[model samples]
Structure formats: C-alpha cells, structure tokens
Target: MTAETLTVVDTGRDKKREQGQAELVAAAVEAARPGLDKIPDPVEPDGDGDLTAEEKERLDTCIGGVELLSTAFWIAGKSLDTMAKGHLIRRIPHKLEPERYYETIEEWAWLEYGIKRSRCAQLRAAWALGEVLAARGYHAPEGQVRELVPLKRKYGLNAGVAMYEIAVEQHGADKVTAQRLRDLVKLLPEDLALKDNDDADQIARMFGGVLEHAEPKALSAGGAIPTDVRRGVDRRALDLANVLNRRRIPRTEVERHLLEAFADEEDTTVFDAVLARMKENKGK
Candidate 1:
C-alpha cells in the first residue's frame, strides 16, 4: 500500500485504540434511529368559530409540543453528529450536509421518541446518547460545525453562513471576534451598521478601539476578562475564535469600566457591559 494508505491504516488502528470498533458501531446505530418530526403540527388559531376552553388548551398544548420537539431534535441531532464523527470516523461517512443532517435527524428523533411538550424526552434521549458516547471515551468538538447548515437557502431555512455574512457586513471581523458580544447583547442587523459614528467615536475614546477588518485571535485580553460566565458564553467565544480565526480582534482595547460592570458578577457581565455601552453611545 502507498504511504497514504498506510497512514490510513495506522490512523484506523489509532482510532480503534482510542475507542473500540464495537462501541463506535453501537453509537452510529443509536444516533440513526428516532427520526425527526413525529408530532402533528399545532392547530390553527380560532378564526371563524367561538373558542372553547378545551380547544384553547389543546391548541396551546400543541404549540408547546412543537416547541419541545424542535428543541429535542436539535439537541439530539447535535449529540448524534458528535458521536458519529468520533465513533464511526471513516465508516458510514455522513454524506448528508451538516445542517441538513441536523434538521433531518431532529425530525426523526421527534417522531421516534414521541417527546412531550416539556421536551423532556428529547433532552433525555440526547443526554443518554451523550452519556453513552462519554462512556465509550467520545467527546464532542469544542466549536460548532460551520456551514454544515448550508451555504445557500432551501426548505425555507436561511443560509448556514447567514449569521457570519451579516456579521461581516455589519462589523466585519468585529463580528467574528465579538460574536459572543453580538449574541449576548442581541445586536440586530440594523446595529450592523454603526447607528452613529458618534458611538464609534466613543469606543475610540475609551479603548482606542476601532472596528477594522483583520484576522481575529483565538482569545485575546484586549477585552474585559471575566473570571466566570455561563458555559454557553464561553462556548460562543471559542466558536467565534474557531470560525473567525483568532486574529479577528487585531487592535481592540478593554476599558476598566467595562470590567467593573461585572461587579454584580453575573458572569454574563462582559456582554452586558458591552451591550450597555453600545446602546448608551448609540443614543448619543
């Protein structure tokens, strides 16, 4: 066999050493089952007829059902993808695009699990799958899979890179670096454009920061650092670094005031501060 083929064989051996073949197959099988969208759609709002208490409750319950199923499928799909890649590795390569796979898997799990409105079933299933993978020595990747959603739109879903595209348009690399900021502050598309140059001017005043296009860094101390934050926020930051590159924030500054805002120590404080500052400056 060629060197490359030898490498594959060696790597395959390494994977087996890392996690046994039997375990991987088991994970793949479990991940594939319980396909998406098993529940019926919610009832239409009462438009022509008088509403009955039972009818209203049923409709409400169904609406909740949709929400729960969607969330569970999402969780299950994420967990399965991770497990598949970690376990199966070369076998049963996932031909389906990442995002498409996610949607499809979610639908499958929703139907298969018969999850209730509480979404307890889906969460349980995902958690159980995660536990199984963990027991087999599998771990999910740190960052999310990008564009696995899709580059273009289809089936009424937006492009996978839509968020990045919007971030690029609005803040450019700033979007990539400060992804956590954008999400935490809940900045809108309109905010993409500087609502006012004055805010930019203020940021310049405080931190010597200006929005510029450049590669971002994996993690930087240029912004306020927090000792603690939700696992979700940290994950977003890591994702920002992974997707945008670590050098995205080439020349930003952190303000003491921003750090002080963490006085409440909410952990999400950095986001709160940045958001508050942005809004405060926007009004000016």
Candidate 2:
C-alpha cells in the first residue's frame, strides 16, 4: 500500500467518533445547565435491572462528556425535572454509584463492540480538566496545538491528562504547573478514576516510569531488551547450556548468572554476548 493509504488506515476512526460525540454532549449539557436552577425535580431516576439491548444502544448515542455529567448530576440527586430524571434512570444504572458506574457502562459498551460509554466517560474527564485549566487562565501550549488537534480528532476535548503532560513537558514543570494539574482534576465529573491525592500521585509515579525509560541515552545504550525480556533471554541461554552441558546448567540459577555472562564478550554470545569477545582463543 502507498504511504497515503497507510496513513488513512492508521488513522483512529474510533477516537474521531468519540470526539464528535463529546462535542454534541457538551452542547446538550450547556443547554441543560442554564435551566437547572429553575427546575423543581432535578434528580434523574435509576435503571433497576439490566439495560435492554435498545437502552444499551441509546447509551452509545451519548458520549463521554454526557455520561460523566449525567453521572455527576445523577449522583448529586439533581435533574431538570421528573421527566428528565426518569429518562436518565431508565437509561443507565440508577443503583450504582458514580464510582462503580464505569463497570456497568464498560460491560454494555464492550458487548456491543461499538462505541462504548466508558470512552465517553474518559473524554468527559478530559473535558472537565480543560474547563478547570481555562478557568485558571491557562491554554494549550503552542506546539501542543498540532498534536492536540490530532488527539482531539481521535479522542476529543477530553484528552486532559495527556494534553497537560505535553504542556508541562513543553513549558517546564514548577509550582504553577503542579497547581494547575491539581486544580483541573478537582473539576472532574463524578465517577472519575481518581479518588484522592494518592490516586493522582500513583498516576504521576507511572508517568515517572515512562520518562525514566524514555531517555534517549538509555535507549541508545545498546538498545537492550527490557528487564522482562532480559529474563526471557537469560532463560533461553540456560536452555542452550542444558544442551551443551555434560551436566546441564541449572535453570533456577539462570537469572542470577546472566549478568556475569553479560560482563564478558566471549561468554556473552550464548549467555553474555558482550562478555564473549573478551575470552581468549574462543571461537563460536
């Protein structure tokens, strides 16, 4: 296939569809919000049993932002009216709390093998973060604009953490950066993955792992396989030795001694290729 064709194939149509849904949901919520204070019955009702294939189907018509807001508004026990509340309760699990809502949503969406409510929930989270950031006098970084456009094309307005991570990378992290992130997260819709500061910190630690492994110097340092892959390689080496051994090399000790072979080029080819060449009069 030509390059152009390949690009088209690689394009994430699912993400684009998600983003489009978010835009629509955003419009609906905005319209709904202004009338909220005037409405008497603000709580949407809950769906008691399993959603039918049709109700499950309508859930797809909703996007991430809508699900999130619906979750929040539902949990808050506020809806535009009894009619609206009935509509929501009939549509989604009314019994489940916002935190547990994703589980049910994921199941239904996955069952259909089409656009899922879980994706919309993620997008809504991203959108809330953006809203919080904008409220704090921030904007997407200049270079990130191009990248975000594609992500937005794929993921929608809800690509919050990733978008912020890019911004932080480009702009540099400090008190302001951290503050903005914390602030934005505070505005997340109900049923967001984060429960507390620890949750946020866990995510940060995960990102730290990414950065630590992403260093160019580390990548270029022989482009060695990762620790897990190294374990597999070492196992292979021991199996090779079991073949060579008058007494086979012990498989149990393979992980420990693989490092030793790595140190010398001569022993290295089988176990430590780097160490194997260091040996004198060795031919393989």
Q: Tens digit of lDDT per residue, candidate 1, span 1-284?
A: 89999999999999887778678888898755444453345566667787778677766666665545434544665565564445533333234444333334334434545544335333433443333323433331112112212211221122222333344445544334333424422222111223222332242332222223322323343246443442334455457667867743222211233445555566776778678989999999
Candidate models: Cα lDDT each: 0.41, 0.44
Q: Any idea what lDDT model 2 has?
A: 0.44
Stretches of candidate 1 off by over 4 Å are 1-50, 93-284
Q: Model 1: C-alpha RMSD to truth? A: 23.0
Task: State how far residue 47 of model 2 sits from its true place (Å).
Answer: 58
Model 2: per-residue Cα lDDT over 188-262, one tens digit each? 221223323433235545444433323122121124446566456546855787787724333324534555555
Give TM-scores for every candidate, taking all chains together and pairing residue i with residue i.
0.22, 0.24
Per-structure clash totals for the candidates: 21, 27
Error of 2 at 153 (Å): 22
